[model samples]
Target: MGEKQQRDRDLTRWGVSRRYSSLDMFYLFPIGEGLHTIEHKGRLFDLLIQNRGSDTTLVVFHGSLPPTQLTLPCLQGEGVSRLADVNLIALADPSLVMGDIDCAWFLGDRRIGPLRPILSPVIRYVLDSLNSKRTILFGGSGGGYAAVNFAQDFPGSIALAMNPRLNFNGTPSSKLPRYLEVCHGAMSRTPMLRVKRDFMTPNLLDDVNKQQDFDLLVVQNKNDKRYLHRQVNPFLSGVENPTRTWVSLFNGGDGHVPLPREEVAKLLKDLSNMESQTSDEYNSLGFESLGDYKQSVLSQDFS
Candidate 1:
């Protein structure tokens, strides 16, 4: 009969095992290290959180998945242990009305109006609950777009993206057009330019240039020619502040895919350690940048 009672009834109807007294209570509940669905503002977010009892939280956003499948990468095999002691949370993007869509860059679905506004608050709530002092956003491809986009909301956070697609509007062959038509209710007759600009920013560089406090680490595979020329190169060149961004170009892996997981792990660990120390301290300790760090790690990996 009451609002809380109605909400409880809905959760029970949806087959949720537990009942929460309130949304705040749900967000505050001690989360064990595993897959969880946090309901916020009438939307459900699937998050796989690996808690390591550390002050740092690494939120990994998944790239485009296969048709009709919703699998989170880095969840299998080595799992979150590759990041070591940092708390890792892997998030799955909500599908559009179509079931085959992989990711929408956390742009929200028909059910939930705009996603980032809702999703950002939900993540902030989670970070607060975890008492996270430092935050890192990681992802590849479309997920990379999400990592950089969301980093704008959390200033001073780290955004580690691998071969990220920065311009959705420019890449007409990408899933953006279809995503707009299905999720945002754009008609076939509607101009794509209007749809893209109306629903979300056409380019991520626009947002990246505006944020001053965050650090961006972009790892790109040189073989991904299309992305290298269109997305990565353009994005990097457009960056107003080179000091806040790091780029690592390598020849590992095939087109568009990220470098080997082991190499990525080494980079993450090295960056995590170095970031914990101030720049002056890091320079004093003889480290210039993550590019140098990547080279060092690569030399060791090959040898």
Candidate 2:
């Protein structure tokens, strides 16, 4: 397809036209609490916003979908609006729209460039204009990967991830290879090399261990043996700072399923209320038992 044809196709697929990149461009249009198109480095970033004029903003990211599912998740529903003290902004992973992939962790395809780098500045621009004092990024499963991935860019941000895929190295899903083929310029097809590339900084447990600025709260269902063995165990084993990185285990749900929305809202509300406290006092945020769980992971062979 030609450039114009491709742009038109994307426009139809994404459903936005008025692109804004800078503060000047953003103010050119009357951006309110709804879906808006953000143009960053010639690529359109879809953002759904609920402008409550609050100091705190909850940025929600959606997880993977079935191949037949076309519409963006979290966009059509009343997402994260239960917390009235915060403004809302939700992002759709643009990579899902481009061909047979279901989840790319918002890593973006080669043509679209790296999404986190592009989106970091764009989101910061939007948050600056909104005068947001605090940010909380929320997601589950694949979306949880993206929530933690992007939260690193914004210091003092909190990432609430449930049953998150910490690294793409060992994931059996073909989407990672498909993403590498499509997004990373068709690099080496070898699995080992692919694993190396996938787990680079900002996208792996090793990188997350080095992160001290942002608080990470990972909620895992104890019944989900798959995630416990594949993701949660390995992640907890590598955690450097127990205070900053919290692992909360619940005794419900099966493999890869999300926690009840009511529980999620409670955690978010707790984090939002404690945003004003210094980093030292963050351990008192009602997750004091996380270290015990981490110790249990270490004692057993959950890996």
Candidate 3:
């Protein structure tokens, strides 16, 4: 249907090694990670790639966490403990981290101080390896922050963002920041964010300007309990990107993270439909309106 799907099947053929970071490891090694340089900023970004053959690259920015490899299974095992658990997981997941990771890896971290500058080397590495004219970026939560932030600073690439964390100025003053803050704190210099109101960017909803210059894709579950569809409404209210798709899956479940694959296939199919559209903004997610954003995607496609 599209390069993504074919690429997916091809990856299946190659199969995946164990979950180790190195392809050379004794495990299965379907994916590989390394350090690369983005000459523009003269900085190096940690790069992780899932081999799908071909050189078309997808640069995925992880959320507040270290990397998808470290985050997802952790989600499956310990499960999310914070209010933003769902947001962190779905926004940053297997696909963003592993999934159909083929081609060159253009992985980035949550490092602060102009993430683009810090990740310039990784970006350059992926671009240099590609024969295609376009490179796609996918991220959610903080990575969603990166998707938009990167698109804003580096406007040439395509971006797909899910329940992103673009609220740089909106975090609540809980006297302490959230746990995510502990990791990314070095960059922003703020402690962990307090829940809900403490850490999200203040004007995030109104800040999709960065999304304008490139091929952009957006995924959101109205039911996401963490970020709350209401929190992001202002951002998407007037978004004009035809390439953008707002999938209202698992409404109100966890405003932060996305539901498991058993619940997300419909949203995935929505992406598949894009293969035939010139540029689509599929608002197939069943939210009746923006305010009722938290209804269950499984329970209410009618919401």
Backbone atom clashes (below 3 Å) for every candidate = 0, 1, 48
lDDT string, candidate 1, 197-256, tens digits: 555777888876776578777778878878877777666666666577666678866677
- What global local distance difference test value does model 1 have? 0.65
lDDT of each: 0.65, 0.67, 0.39
* lDDT ranking of the models: 2, 1, 3
Across 25-118, the per-residue lDDT of candidate 3 in tens digits comes to 3122222433211122222222333323433345556554432232222111112211111111111222222222321112222333323443
The residue ranges of model 2 lying beyond 4 angstroms of the native Cα positions read 1-18, 21-24, 27-31, 40-42, 72-77, 83-85, 171-174, 184-203, 275-286, 301-303
Instruction: Report the C-alpha lDDT of model 2 over 139-253, residue by residue, as the tens digit.
Output: 8888888888888898888887888888676543435666665555465658536544543443467677766678787888878887777776777777776767776778876
Flag regions of model 3 displaced more than 4 Å: 1-44, 66-113, 153-156, 170-207, 238-248, 259-277, 280-303
Displacement of the residue 64 alpha carbon in candidate 1, Å: 0.3
Residue 269: error of model 1 in Å? Answer: 1.7
The clash number for model 3 is: 48
Taking all chains together, each candidate's TM-score versus the true structure is 0.77, 0.81, 0.49
Predicted model with the maximum TM-score: 2
